[model samples]
Target chain A: MSSILKKFLMALTGLALVGFLIAHLGGNLYLFLGRDHFDGYAKKLEEMGPLLILAEIVLAGLFLTHLFMALKLTGENQTARGAQGYADNSKNQSTPASRWMWITGLFVMMFLVVHIKMFKFGEREKPITAKGEEIIKAFNGEEAAKQFARESGEHGSLYGLVQKEFKRPAVVGFYVVLMLVLGAHLSHGIASAFQSLGVLRPGWLQCLKPWCVALAWLIALGFALLPVCTFFGIGIN
Target chain B: MNFTLNVWRQKNANDQGRFETYQAKNISPEASFLEMLDVVNNELEAEGKEPIAFDHDCREGICGACGMMISGRAHGPRAATTTCQLYMRNFQDGETLTLEPWRAKAFPLVRDLVVDRSAFDRIIQAGGFISVNTGNAADANALPVPKDNAELAMDAAACIGCGACVAACKNASAMLFVSAKVSHLALLPQGDAERVRRTLNMVKTMDEAGFGNCSNTGACEAECPKSISISNIARLNREYARAKLLS
Candidate 1:
């Protein structure tokens, strides 16, 4: 594919992923409503069965394609300079986030692997079905500590799993840092996607860069806060 | 002022070049950087040695012919100043400076400190012109161009195609140059007819010429003689993506 087309595909796939994050965040937010709401949300997602699997497959394709194209394009860009390189590279005018995109992207990609393993598609899912489900149910039943805790019964209790996982300081720290890296990647990527698709205007340039970066920060904050709040027992019974 | 000059010396395009150091003594502080080179070249000529062959025309900044790497930075250390506009006063009396050509795969080395920039001309040839023929000058206010757009077009049109953007880029990307040309025309009504074709063809030419993809490093903008905005690059991407989607 042409470089331009590759970039367009990246933008399309990236924006779609961002849309998925929004929905995922919304569903995750139901955790604050207690165990029944949280597990029910997960059940609804799994209940889609083939449709959910199809969506996951599409999501994986979009994600891998984005990574693949980004790597290829970055490699080509590096080769274009051949052996010639600037002696005073520090003089470049791009932002720090813009400059370190590949590094941050790589980090984010690594985090994504760990993330899917830990939460989405890793060994966490295996024990979830094999034995951990009952343990989670027991934890959810001990909600007598808080008066505001919803009376929830007969669910997988993902709320317990989340609460248990976040209580670990190391896990929460890793998540918070990962969210920041994800923020940096999204900050450049969002406005850049618009420019890649030819939708950005000069008038929008000033507004777009900061707003996009800010939006990335907001999303990061939203994600980052979850572990912090979980550690503080916001939704834990 | 007296200084040591480390000039890139390549006999021909195929010849491997290395820095040939020479002493430039008794140089005027106010002399342009090119003039200091001229003095050194005259001294070389007096001794029957080959004067350093570099590209320059219209010693002022506007012509776009004069360009070289002065101490690793394109044009010169001063931001928004062309090599021709750079003065010896900017350097210290005992300063040692290195001069090299704008290095890119697309820009083939012709000799010392001069690379064939006709690749740029070819890129311009691809779609830099409007096909529309305006018969004659109509009224003073004939074709209406919005004021802000007119100014922005002129801002983009200010690019002299000096290849500083190419020089500054770590990837050797020409997105800024291509975008400047595309945008200058795209923002105008006369440019409307060829907008799609122009962006597509120019980008194709740029890519085929072995230029790198833009990383939006803004190095080009930092070193540009005209200070062309990277936003133009964003516009170029925008235009290129639109063209690809349509045709």
Candidate 2:
């Protein structure tokens, strides 16, 4: 495919990921609504059954496409530099985020794996609560999973899983660091994606860059606040 | 004024380059950077030593021919000035400066401080001209070109095909150069007929020549001798996308 096409795909996937982050942050903010609301939100997702699975599949595809395109583009860029190393590469004018995008992206991917593992496998050593194990044992089939979902009292317990996950200082610290890196990446990325897709005017970028930086910080702070607040028992049960 | 120069020297494209230090003693502070090299070359030639080879056509900056990384900045510490226009007075009396050729895969080293930038020529040849026959000169304002477009086109047209943007770019991208060529033609009424094809062909040629993709890093704009703005690059991207969408 053409390089421009690859760039377009990268930008398209990036914009989609940014959209996903907004939805995710909004959903996670339901934690502030107290345990029942957050737990019901989680239960509602499982209740969607095949639809939720399909959406996750689409999200995974977007993530993979974004990753592959980035690797291919970065490889081409490095090769275009040829076999010489600059004696004073410091002179190249660029933002630190733009220069370090690949490294930050790889770290974000690593964090995603750990994050999904937290949800799917119940937080490594947190010891799934007896209520969680009872639900799992009680619901062996698809019909029972739905029946379990209808019983809101029984389903009100998954928030315990989130509470345990975020209450750990190590998990919270690592999550905060990754969120900061994500912010750095997005600060450059939001405007950069538009420029790459050829939709952004250069004159608009100056006005947009500050806004992109602010949005990045907002997303980072929003995601980070949960674990930080939870770890300090500020609104923790 | 005297200066210490660390000049890069390589026998050919296949050979590894190394820095060769020379003392340019008793040099005039008024001499241009290239002229200082000329005096140093004279001394080397008199001693039966091979003078360091470098590229130069017009000692004036407009030709876009004479260029080298002086002290890691394109065309020396003076911003917006070509190596040929850079004067020795810009350097401190006893300061050391390093000189090297444009280091992009698209512009391979010829020797010493010279690089073959014909990759740019091929990109120009790809679509830098309008093919329509006007046969003879029309009345001065026959085309009725818009003033702002003419000015923007002039800004892009000011590019002299220098590879400084590529040299300064960490990715060694040629986006600024290709964009200049595309925008210059695409902005003109005379070029309207082939605007779409021209953008596609020139950009394809640039990529085929192994130039890197623009990361929107702004390095090219920072170090361009002509002070070519990256807005032209934005235009190129827009044109390239428009072409693909229509195609």
Candidate 3:
């Protein structure tokens, strides 16, 4: 395929991933509304059944395609530069975020693996409340938490798990750092994706960079806020 | 003014290049960057040593022949200025300067501070022209071109094929140069006949030459001596997509 086509695919998949991030951030922000609202939202997603699985499949496809194109293009770009490099190379107008995209992208991918492991497949302990402890004791411990959750029309104790995870200084610190890396990736990726797909014009060019950066940081700040607030007991009871 | 020069020196393509320091003494601050190099070469010749080899033509900066990375910048520290037009007055006395050639897989080093940029000529040969019958020039008002398009075409046409865009690019991508050539012709009525074929063929040729893909860093536009806008790159992408869809 032509280099432009490769970049076009990269841009398409990248933009799709950005859409997923926005939606995911919006849903995750329901945590601030307390345990019932957050767990109910999770339950509603699970209630989609096969449709939720299909959505997950599509999201996975987009992320894999984006990763594939990034690796292929990055390898080609490195080879195209030849073996001998400059003695003292310096950037003229590129930002740090733009120049270090590959590194930031790889870091985000690694962060995603840890994130999914922690949230999706990890243990969800019962909430630390008087009624919650009594229910756990009466239902015969941690395994009954899911049964109780289903009976009560919720998605287990996911809110409690999130609160427990964020209460750890190390976990909160890791989440915040990864969110910043994600922001750096998006700062370049958003504007670059538009340029790659030929969606920008000369008139929009002046405002595009700043707007992209602002939007990227805003999303990062939104995600980062959840962990920080949870760590400080702002949204926890 | 006097300066220290650490210039890349290589006998040939097979030679392992290295930076060699030379002292430029009693240089005039009014001299252009190339003229200062000429003074150093004269001194080397007087001392019965090999002088530095570089490229230059029409030192007025229009010919696109003279270029080198001066202290890590494509054309010294001046914006929209080529090496031949960059005067020594911009630098302080006793400053140390480093010079290197444009390095890319498509641009093989030929000698000291000179690389073969014929890859650009090949890209041009692919489709950088309009096909018309051999006859007298057409009347200026015969074909009406919109004022905005004409100005935009002129902006793209200002590109001098200097290869500075590649030098400035972190990936050594030539998207800016190729886009300028593509845009200058594609924006005109005379180029409408073969626009699809031209965009496809030129892009294919550019890829086959081993140039990297554009990452939209804007460094090319920032360091372009002609100040060629990256808007040309966006236009090139649109043209390429349109051609792909049409065919």
- The two-chain DockQ for each candidate, comma-separated, is 0.45, 0.54, 0.71
Per-prediction TM-score, chain B alone: 0.98, 0.98, 0.98
Ranked by DockQ from best down, the candidates are 3, 2, 1
- Residue-level lDDT tens digits of model 1 in A28-121: 7887788767777887888899999899899899889988988888888877776755444565656788778888989988988877776764
Worst 10 residues of 3 chain A by lDDT: A146-155
lDDT for each of the candidates? 0.83, 0.85, 0.89
**In candidate 1 chain A, what residue range of length 10 has the lowest lDDT sum?**
A122-131
Give the winner by lDDT: 1 or 2: 2
Better of 1 and 2 by TM-score: 2
lDDT of 2 by residue, B1-247 (tens): 9999999989998897798899999989899999999999999999999998988888888999899888788888778899889899888999998888889888988889889999999998998999988568888998799998999999999999889999988788899999898888888988988988888898889899999888877888888989898878778888998998876
Clashing pairs in 3: none
Model 2: residue A41 alpha-carbon error in angstroms: 1.8
| Single-chain TM-score of chain A, each candidate | 0.84, 0.85, 0.88
lDDT of 3 by residue, A151-206 (tens): 45422478878988999999999999999999999999999988998878777777
Error of model 1, residue B14, in angstroms: 3.1
lDDT of 3 by residue, B1-247 (tens): 9999999999999998899999999989899999999999999999999999999999999999999998888988899999999999999999999999998999999999999999999999999998765267778777899988899899999999999999888888999999999999888888888889999999999999999989998989999999999888888999999999998
- DockQ measured for candidate 1: 0.45
